[model samples]
Target: MYHSILDTSVEFIKGVGPTKADVLKKDLGLFTFRDMLAHYPFRYIDRTKFYKINQINPDSQYIQIIGRVISKKVIGDKRVKRIIAVFKDETGIMELVWFQSLKWVDTNIQVGVAYVAFGKPNLFNGTFSISHPEMELYQNRHLGRGNLTLQPVYNSTEKLKKFNLDSKGIQKLIAGLLDQVIPQVTEDLPQYILDKYQLPDKRTALLNIHFPKNQQDLNAAERRLKFEELFYIQLQLLHNKQLRQLKFKGASFELVGEKVNRFYKEFLPFELTNAQKRVVKEIRIDTQRGVQMNRLVQGDVGSGKTAVALMSMLLANDNGYQACMMAPTEILARQHYASIISLVSDDLVKVAILTGNTKKKERNILHEQLENGEIDILIGTHALIEDKVQFKNLGLVVIDEQHRFGVEQRAKLWRKNVIPPHILVMTATPIPRTLAMTLYGDLDVSVIDELPAGRKPIETRHLYEGQRLRMFGFMKQEIAKGRQVYIVYPLIKESEKLDLLHLEAGIEQLSYQFPRPDYQMSIVHGQMPNADKQFEMQQFIEGKSHIMVATTVIEVGVNVPNASVMVIENAERFGLSQLHQLRGRVGRGAEQSFCILMSGNKLSKEGRIRLETMVKTNNGFEISEIDLQLRGPGDITGTQQSGVLELKLADLASDQIILSEARNTVIALFEDDPQLDKPENSMLKAYLQKLQRGISFDKIS
Candidate 1:
């Protein structure tokens, strides 16, 4: 019954008839009373203060003045027409101008009449004026009047403004609707929750949000609404998780057999970091359990994620089940294949690679081998999920850079085996704890926080254009030491808008700096043919090229341990994550590596912060927190795809404490009533059903 009241059409509201209703829907997506309630104000104005005309200055942001209109006149004609009025208080006189609705403004004005005006103050010709000020008769500005209280400033489009539906108009319409709906707004939360959280009832919250009696009321209303929003999201996620665990059965791998032992004993490339060992054990426990394992392994760049993934894959093979890995790009897939081949050289594991570039005959052979279980581990791009490539007893799947694949693509891979395979998703881009809780909250997360032993942190320095000669000398010295260099440009072609260096021009400049016969050079960019790109990358990896000039295409999958120097030209143009990934390309070997960020002398505040963050620490999680601040949650690569991040008032960026509290409360609630079968939780169950009907979060699984 309460929901029905809120779901009534806006056209049924007293002031908003059919015409205004259509405009509101077309302009702001407000179809019902519920929509209007959700459309919270972006700002509020204090209407109690009135400034004298003498206090108006050029620096004033927005001011309210009480004065009488001494004179009025129409100035200019047609397109440039405006109505000007001279308003005077006892202190001084100020000009009030209206550029829009000139005829309406001119007809409504009277000489020697008092009015209260509000607007931003503008100074021209050594005089102060208020242009397009919101004016009202001074008699209506007394205490207890509407204009004497705090006013909500809502967001509206110009199309709505055409029908007198700007912020003020919307507020008036909301006032009319509240009169009818506020009485019917019932509490959605159980009585215990309201008491425990010290939250106001639903009707009070709705009333105060649209028309707060005081600052305390506004803050309380905001807190109650934010908590409710975040709480429901947590409830839905945990509920889905519980259902998934109860419904889906997993294949049990009860053996730690030949293949894993062989790789651990002889084919191991380096001593396993304790972090890596812990993560591998976690995967082992998950696989052995009779439930499907969906885990996210997060680590910094070059933190041995692939090593852990390979060890887990070997565990699957030991139990008579084949494993497959999927990557976003062909290059990463091939790189993974090469790394796996090298790791298992002394072992008896069969590994195969399939990608778009693979020969048709070779692919046919691979298809046959894979179906017959001849391939123990297969690494490929999207080709791994093709209908023809079937696995005999697929047990585990590892997705590299998991955010690059959409939900549908991952779903296709999960459906390959009758009972879906154990899933391990990996990412080098570290996600903050709050984001991980909301974005991948359902999956069990494991972090390899520490880097491996014997690896030195990359030395990063910020350099400017004036230091070009010194940078060149340093590059020459590194090349003299038989180490390679990577010079990355932000763009492939010159952009007129951004004054950053491009890859083609960067290559030419480097060629001139170190001429042929002395320094070997290679170039790579996105526009190059795949064969050409592979050839140049392979040349750099083989140590045949001393300097490689490229774009951010090398930000991933290219692992050259011997490349001891990364020179990022115009590095300020890149995001913190991209810059960090590019820097990760180096520092893979024993010797100390350097990342020299080249930028112009002048930098924006954000650009300086990003560069400073790169110079401060090598902690990916810390960098990610700052990145989340600079670029909001929606702008981050993976967070937007998870529909949960589209929060209205509860900020994942700022409200971490509230979010944690909400999650804990929801967890405790479910402990007592798992299915929400109690009468008190019926409202919560209905709310959850509404959220489920609107969102399809199946992608997270």
Candidate 2:
């Protein structure tokens, strides 16, 4: 059995005592041997060769040199001492200077002693020199593997330094540990499988990664590990998909009769976009089929996805089954309830709201109604998952802004009923088609590509810090026309510790500029309680507050048709997709909306490019594509987002084609010999077993 080194205490390891172990545990979170093993080198230092002192040009880059100290002199005072030494190599002579460690260097260095010095080469006056260079005493037997190859450099805490354990010390410890852990190369995979895939043994790969002799070995080790990590993740996802498909069947709501048709003809405020109709049709067809529906409906902000969701819920109600919509926040859940209540006949379709703040009596009543199938649709936050809550024949479960929830939470929802409800996850963030395919490979996806009639696009603009006065004047003009405004800051509280700007300062500045008595203003941020945030949001939505200065907490939920202007402070601080989402909060109504991005004068090149892109187009998909190019997939979806399949060797952005090929290879192998009972297929099974740690691939069987 393979053992984790994390089980061993740091004190048990050689070179680490009680004092050092305490520092490691408290400061670096390194309590065991495995922690140090996993703490991979941040960078490598090349010490392959040494340069002659005289041969070194003034403009030459950093190089190591072997030289003998000819003379040493103490120049400066005790408080600011400087030790200057003259050294001569085979080619020429140079000066070696030490600043703070003069006493140590003076005692250690002896005239005519040959030693190795490593540092950057620079010219001062007309001579070549190295200041405060890292040096080692010359001894043929004590060379300590002098600059022979690349050396791993680790990261250590200041506390470790106090205990005489720094980066170099940690590196030596890891090197010694590698020497003791004998390679236990078990044949987890068949020999034929290893040959076909050209994979190294697991033990060899692990050892080489920590102590590689050359670049080729490092590359091979990395390839093996990355592939193994991604393969296991993919295997787990595929297995989950199989288990879900086999274990649960959705209640198919087939009829599209009076209620859906009546709402479409009379109650619907606007005609359905062709994209919306297509997605609705896809959902209807999926529900009609006997299998559980796991689909993702992605659309750009303001693309009318909520309308499609409401229509699907209506379909379920007509077929005599209850449906529920779960949002990530209370405001969003309330918004959906209000919007749907306005569009549907309340008598025909009963709707209820359940949030964390719901009264206990009300919750009990709602639970009873939900369990008895009296409520047609229930909308809420995560409180919907409480053990007390039950649904009578839950036909459909629509998750809004699905990325906010984790995989385990989604799985919990699926288990609420014996036959899992038809799952439709919706997101306003428009992901590119390629990324969508990998991230949501298991789910059938539907896209809503159009907005409703009279939905005007917001005009976007980028302004430098110098143009803030002009932007303020423009905001005043917009406010004069009875339009509300949202001025968003980046932080919640003013912190004396941080050098960055805070939201409280922005609120103070805006209050001075727009002066609260003249224009009513309110502030909201994450630090505020939920009720206070909702109260401030309510004031803005009711037109009681003319200008609301808040943080990105308003990015997802707050919907105000009257708010015509969106001003994002420190616009460069936000990611492209986030900026787009914030911009989407406005332009919800017929009145033309404006998005003003205020950036600091000193902006990064990428930041400038991001701002320029935001000004160029309102298409969230285009912005997402650019974001993928600039920041990569990890930042776009966040590292923990469920749909983001973590890859080891392949980049989801750059190596899409390669990933497709690998996926195809796996699929073809599985299809040709499902159980892998044949000899040729047995190797593939071995490869899968080596890759998928605990997850099983019995779906093929």
Model 2 over residues 1-701: C-alpha lDDT tens digits?
22444357788778887888888888877777656666666655566666877678867776778889999988867788798889888788999998764555777778899888777877999888898776656564233333336666577765675564666678678777656553533333335545756878766776666666677877776666555544444544454565566767778787997778888998998888999999999999989987899999999988988899988988988887788899998888998888889888876678899999999999889999999998988999999887788887888889998878888777777767777788989998888766776677678899888888888889999998899899999999999999999988777776677444578778777878987578998788888898998898889989998998888988887778999999998899899999999998999988999999998889899999999999999888889888988988767876456534544345666655545544554455446665567875554456456445754321101
The count of backbone overlaps in candidate 2 is: 1
Where model 1 places Cα greater than 4 Å from the true spot, the runs are: 49-149, 689-701
**List of clashing residue pairs for candidate 1:** none
Compared with the true structure, all predictions reach lDDT values of 0.85, 0.77
Error of 2 at 651 (Å): 5.4
Best candidate, TM-score: 1
RMSD of 2: 5.9
RMSD of each: 3.9, 5.9
Looking at candidate 2, the ten consecutive residues that score lowest on lDDT are 692-701
TM-score of each: 0.90, 0.77
Residue-level lDDT tens digits of model 1 in 166-192: 777787788877777777777876888
